[model samples]
Every structure is written in C-alpha cells, then in structure tokens.
Target: MTNIQVLDNPTMHNLLINLSKEESFTFREIIEHTLESFSVNGERQYQPPPSIVNRPNGQNTLFRPFTSDTCIGTKITVESGPDGQGRKSPPHGVIVLTDSKGNPTGLLSSNEITGYRTSMNAFRFLGERMWIIL
Candidate 1:
C-alpha cells in the first residue's frame, strides 16, 4: 500500500485520525520524559539562566525580555520500502528539539510516536472486535 493510497481510503483515514491523536499524546509523554531527564548543574545552570532580566544603561528600568521553552517536533517520512514499488511500505522519521539558539538539542530516531499510534489503533480495533472495550 502506498502512502498516497493510505491517505485516500476511508478506513485508513479513520485510522490515521486516531493515529494522529495517539501520536500527539505519545509525543507529549516523550517530551515530559526528556524534560525530567534534563538537569542543570554547575556551568550548565549559569551558562543560560531560565530567564534573563536586564537594565539599560542610564535607565533605572528592569526588564525580562528573554524566556525559553522546549518541545520535540516529530515528522514522518516514507521511502519506497524494500520492494521498491511500495507494495509493502514502512515509515521513517525522527524527533528533534531545538535549543534557545534554534539549534538541534537532541536526535531521537526511534519512530516511537508512529509505533505507538499504530499499536494503539490495532489494539483498540481488536478490543472492539472482542467486546473488551477497556
């Protein structure tokens, strides 16, 4: 099945709809884990303060004009899988986070969001079939 066909079919469309939801939830989880894993110690902490407040020379004014937040952006790609014609296809993508300077902070190529979405869709479908709606 081709990616274009996957986007065209109604069943696939529904699956994709749920897949997107799952991917979003999974991506949030991944970000939470990453944030939990991060630490600020010694130079790392002082290197870039979470927020910077500065006062202009000759002006008795304090201002916090710089702040930063972090998140992981996920993107998916499909390359003619194994058979070359996409008779059987697979997905490839990665997750990356940008630093305050807009540079890549980490490279996570697990395709975890895709796998989570696929598995959740199939599991839900099967559970419905088995009347185990949990």
Candidate 2:
C-alpha cells in the first residue's frame, strides 16, 4: 500500500536542504544513477515535450509528461503574464511510481523534486568537470 504524503513548500524545502547538506552520494554516482534510470532492458526512454497555453488572465501554463522504467508523471507549471512579464509560480505536479504490476506504488510532488534534482545535476556536472585542467 502506498501512503500519500502531502508536503507544503516549506516542508519540501527543508527536506531538500537536509539531503543536500548530507552529500552522501558522490558526483559520479549521481550521473551514473540518472543515466541508468533512463533505460531498463533495452528501450529508449520517452517524455512528452512541454506545451504551453495562454490563460484568459494573460498567464501561461505549461504541461509536460515524462516516463521511465519505474515512474510516470505529468507536470503543470503556471507562469504569470503572456510574455512571462509577471510573477511566476513554481510547478505544481504529481509523480506516480509504479511497480512490476503497473500499479502506482508511490506518489510524490514534482515542484521540489524538480528543484532538488536540477540542483543535484548542476552539482554533478561541476564535480564531473571540475578536475579538467587547461
């Protein structure tokens, strides 16, 4: 049984911060893990490109879907103003992780996950390239 956990922004931020400080995984490990997750036996991973729609209030919303061997999810992000001239809010989305039976075994919020993952990737890139010298 999958237990649903609803985490607000503050809680999510705190959790991510804690994980970042831990630095348990090395940079190379992160890169390897990400690449491995993209494929399973031998199939290319696929994800839907983001689509944007303009709202009546001059705002724009983006929708995207991604899938891997273990997870499937859709993300919707709201941006204020037609030209992105107004305040933009973080993405509010859901991620569903499935089991071998194709049943959802876990649900997670995407906003903080995106933020945390992006930061981790950046760190990984730096760590991977930092050793290169001119």
Candidate 3:
C-alpha cells in the first residue's frame, strides 16, 4: 500500500490557486503538454480496453482505465439523471491516480477533474479551429 492524499474539491481548488501563483503558471502549459499526447507519434505503453458504459435504472455510469508516459489512472463516474426537485444528486465516483510502482498516490473528485479536462479540451480544439476561420 502507498500513501495517498485524498482532497475534496475546495481543498484541491485552493491548493491549485496557490500553486499557480507560486509557479507563475496557468494550466495552458499543462493542457498543451497533454494535447501533445494525442498527436501522430504519441506513445501508449499499454493499450486501453474498451470502456464500460451501462445504464441500469435509467442512470449512466462510465468506467475507464487509461495510461500514458507519465501516469496511470482510472475514472469511474455515475450520473443519476438530471436535476429535479427535492432530490439530492448522487455523489459521483473518483479519479484514482497511482504511481509507476503501482501504488495509489491520490484520489481526486471525478467531477472536478472531468469538468476541467472536458472544458479545456473543448476550448483548445475550438480555439485552434476558430483561428483558421478568422
């Protein structure tokens, strides 16, 4: 077993803000680096199996395991339909990050990371294409 830091959304956001200022950095560099992994020559140490997507009780769940040169992690999430009256939304799953030694390093909120990655990817893709149209 490896030591792991489990941080909630607020803690994670606060830490990231401080780190951004301290390093004088934004996520642009990180996102750009990640985008590089999508190119023609990017390497995958191991291929990913087909993801699992099932909807029992009319709810959605997706479980995916992926690897790269820097890390390996899994994201498991569930969506219990849309927002409604007087109902608390279900707590989604987590993104579990493990190191090269195969020991768990961190467990982060799935929603937070997923939202950020999705939004960034959309913007980067659109931004690149929009420049061409102008």
Better of 1 and 3 by TM-score: 3
TM-score of candidate 3 on Cα atoms, chains taken together? 0.67
Model 1 C-alpha lDDT per residue in residues 1-134, reported as the tens digit of each score: 12111122344345545656668567555644443454332323322323322333221222112123543233323333345453644544444445555565544443454555556556655757889644
> Which candidate number would show the highest lDDT if scored against the true structure?
3
lDDT of each: 0.43, 0.63, 0.68
Clashes of 1: 0
Candidate 3 lDDT (Cα, 0 to 1) = 0.68
Best by TM-score: 3
- lDDT tens per residue, model 2, 91-131: 46655555545665656666777777777777777877886
For residues 1-134, write the lDDT of model 3, one tens digit per residue: 44898977777667554655424235755866764663333444364754656564556777777677667788787767655564547748788888876788889876666666667677777878999999
The window of 10 residues in a row where model 3 has the poorest summed lDDT is 38-47
Stretches > 4 Å off in candidate 1: 1-68, 72-74, 81-86, 117-134
Sort by lDDT, best first: what order? Answer: 3, 2, 1
What stretches of model 3 exceed 4 Å from their correct place? 16-25, 38-40, 81-91, 125-134
RMSD (Cα, Å) for all candidates, in order, is 18.1, 4.3, 4.1
Off by over 4 Å in 2: 20-32, 35-45, 82-109
